[model samples]
Target: MKVFTQFTDEEVRKAQVSVLELLLINHPLDCPVCDRGGECPLQDQALAFGPGASRYEEAKRTYRKPLPLSPLVNLDRERCVLCARCTRFCDQISGDRFIELFDRGGAEQVGISAGQDFRSPFSGNTVQICPVGALTATTYRFAARPFDVATGDTICPHCGDNLDVNDAWACDKGRFAFSFVDQPTRLTTPLLRDHGLEPASFDETLAAVATWCRGGRAAVLAGGRLSNEDAYALSKLARTGLRTNDIDARPFPCDPSALPAERAQATGGMAVTYRDVELAKLIVVVGLDAEQEVPILHLRIRKAARQGARIVVIHPRRTRSYDVAEHV
Candidate 1:
């Protein structure tokens, strides 16, 4: 079979219209009620190039809505067009064959195997890649529409041990934690606890905390997830403002004697980047589980492997990257 790789803009539009027509044949037009409504690719494509009218007057197929694929991920089979993108992602990228096309032809749809849950570290990627609202994050389902929320860029704090800020990608925690910003119970202002916790002015809260800190030995232990700016601010506040040397940013306990060595590795003149991984003749991944620890890095290494580059992983347990690596 011959495949056309290139096409004119007009041809592309016509193709898109035909594609959307078939996709929408059994798809429910419940955009207002869908979790991916405002930010959906089909939604955008439909507006840009899809046909204004449907020729099919037949009734749409129906199924049980939103079968639970996992605790975090849900599958709306009706919205699925049997693209197999999610299944392919699981089989190729994530190495988790949890979901697959169960039935054949028009009845074909994405589904989790019997006695299996979509329990992959990179499961959310499937949700993000679903062109339609076939896959959705359970926690974020119906939480808010795309236009109803604001977005801003920030660093991932999940893996704070890595000091190189330029190569960071959003882990599951970093991607989903932003939802808390819209939570009603989230703290919006400083609180003072004298007899009981009470909302107080920033100045008053700072003054009270300063007074208490000065009265006794206090230490500021920051989490790895803090942004560079926030970490720096906290460090300044601890040393200059609080007048204390008892401040540390490492969330997990590490040997004090190894601090300088670790710092050197983090800020060294030489660094291994995504490009380096791609071009390297020999890549050795130690202790690090790229699938869970750094999925983006895993993708880079996988690409390199496909290019005939050799990879070696040294770990007690096998990782998803091991599937592509030359040796484990």
Candidate 2:
């Protein structure tokens, strides 16, 4: 007789549902009040592969709710399932050794070290990687729902890294500094100036723009903030729609022809990437200060330096990066 194990999609889903049902036994159904609502993994899992009705009808376990992990990090002990993802990340990746599982078995809970604060540079990652809404950023807590906000895949204006500024995994600045995007004084509608500026529909605005461009020389001055697709569209519009050959994306170019070599170097694609920085034996820093300019870049440089990469900074004044640099 021969026996082999086989699991089909339905069987796997059933097993998943069983596990999730147990996970959700003590979980609160306060999805509306949760900041991670609409983007929560626990909520998604329950909806996708879970028992339609919870069989465990006992009163759910409760804690004080949102025990202070640190000034930046908050812990909702009741929401936690003792999954050590955050603890492991802190121990292995960030090297902070702050967050850890306290106690054992049924009493196991994740927390910061005794008398130690979760003050690591990468503490935000814990709030991001929490499978449930167990860990949350104090600043972003109850600020907005995931569905209420719009997300754009944009590069970090600080460091040019391809990161979504509004994402859960975004750095503190990228996530919380976007409140300016919704200022009450900020323009929300397209403005057209006939005698004075007045809000106009997009179609009307386009018609007015077309009228202004017709039989006139027009140059598309796109910004670096524009996505590559947007830049391409604007380039095409300059040639096909506007009937002009002048189009520029770089903001500081007084004369595009003056610095052909520099322009090529700037737009010729990345000469050195984060990978190169990580693997290089010697890294020479020019005018760029990684720490202030790009915290993530600084972190990468620090990691590389820790791995025996020699860092040399060439600047008149000492930068924050000089802490990690071999020479300044």
Candidate 3:
């Protein structure tokens, strides 16, 4: 079939410019102080596609700035472009309909129902996906500019792409609970027991540890949060260097036979993937609060329920999945 895609077309270019102009009609001119200043998609697009100066001569619409939606998120109604990214994320992806577009015409804005807070475990995602500075993280508000901050590429320990877990999404805790690293009380240097936990250099600490390990038996008990590579390194050090097999990565003991079939599949390396959950006809969740514990899994279960799967959640108390699953 013959088709005409309108890229570089004069009419299409004019239409794009007009859309940018309309989007910026009520957008605040506070980009200097805005958290998303250098990294804002709206700002970049406006500079690229919008006219040199705005034709909006009338007084711009305004609202009370920086409304706290929850303890984690702040909303600026005037900066909102009404693209519905946050609202749609709540309603469609997270299944947490805490916020929605309110009112009509120019007065319309994103807001929560009376007495409701945007307390969803996935609420931070809205801020991450916002095109403008309308939604800003409370912990990260004005923390640093894009130019001031240095970034490093690292695989997230919480969720990763290999498993298709939390694909393009993360729970609030994984997304926003990083402020503790800057605390004054946080240990930046290793400590030695020369007197009473005196600060020591890494060389001194490692030498002391090596001496102690050589003099006596040593076993490695690594945290469960260690990455696969770290765990492997630790395992190698314990088995090869220390000549010991008394190394374990699990924080606690778990009986494989007691685990649910799906969990057992995972623990036993049998590969019960998220696709299995989506295609499941009947899913029985046993003693797992998937929403608070494993949110992405909860989302997958919800998606399955939407696609005609029956979900039964068996727990001591009700959970957030009660809306989509039968609570037992």
lDDT of 3 by residue, 145-196 (tens): 9778986654444533223323557777667655566789989999988668
Tens digits of per-residue lDDT for model 2 on 1-328?
Answer: 7533224466666777889998888888888898888988889878876789988967887888788877788999888888889987766555567888888866677776777788766788888889788999898888898899986666554335526455323455554556677789998889999799999999999998998887647777887667788888888888999998877766332233325434556665768776787898998766665554556676677778889999988765677678778988
lDDT for residue 220 in candidate 3, whole number 0-100: 86
Total colliding residue pairs, candidate 2: 0
Q: How much lDDT does candidate 2 score?
A: 0.75
lDDT of each: 0.77, 0.75, 0.80
- Against the true structure, candidate 1 reaches a TM-score of 0.68
- The most accurate candidate by lDDT is 3
Worst 10 residues of 2 by lDDT: 251-260
| Displacement of the residue 85 alpha carbon in candidate 3, Å | 0.9
Clashing pairs in 3: none
Per-residue lDDT of 302 in model 3: 85
Question: Which of 1 and 2 is the better model by lDDT?
Answer: 1
Best by TM-score: 3
After TM-score superposition, what is the CA distance of residue 109 in candidate 3 from its true location, in Å? 0.4
